[model samples]
Target: MEKREVVVSITDNGPGISEDIQSRIFDPFFTTKPIGKGTGLGMSISYQIVTEVHNGSIQCISQPNQGTTFNIKLPQKYNRVIPQ
Candidate 1:
């Protein structure tokens, strides 16, 4: 069987996320924003979409004041061909 892989990355220049909380960023309702500012489901939903729906993987890399980056990898395989 032949398989293809796709990689994507997203980066931000704002105040980077801390190391202590980086692990829980994908958890449901986990946010560092002020009250009534965020719902905290964004990362959780994204994690589900990539890992569960697409059978892919997601990860985050960040430092206190440097920045943050999200790396995503997805499998690209087709079992049949379609006429174009």
Candidate 2:
């Protein structure tokens, strides 16, 4: 069977993220927000859902002062095993 994928892109016009911080954006408990303002689990959870659950991929592209874009690609069809 031929493999197919669905691509999604989210972009923001706000100041883009720095390279140093982008590397860890998907790490659990890694957030740029101030203390008590954010838990930093959002991205980590999203990454897990896309990559593990759906067999997809997620990436972040940005440049300082330019903008930020998140690209997600999910397989159109995936196989899941059911255990009795």
The most accurate candidate by TM-score is 2
Error of 1 at 49 (Å): 0.3
Instruction: List TM-scores for all candidates, in order.
Output: 0.83, 0.88
Candidate 1 stretches with Cα past 4 Å from truth are 1-3, 78-84
Question: Tens digit of lDDT per residue, candidate 1, span 1-84?
Answer: 667778999999978988889989999999999999999999999999999999999999999888999999999776566779
Clashing pairs in 1: none
Tell me the spans in candidate 2 whose CA falls farther than 4 Å from its real position. Answer: 78-84
lDDT of 2 by residue, 1-84 (tens): 878898999999989999999999999999999999999999999999999999999999999999999999999764654687
Which structure among the candidates has the greatest lDDT?
A: 2
Positional deviation of residue 67's Cα in model 2 after best superposition, in angstroms:
0.4
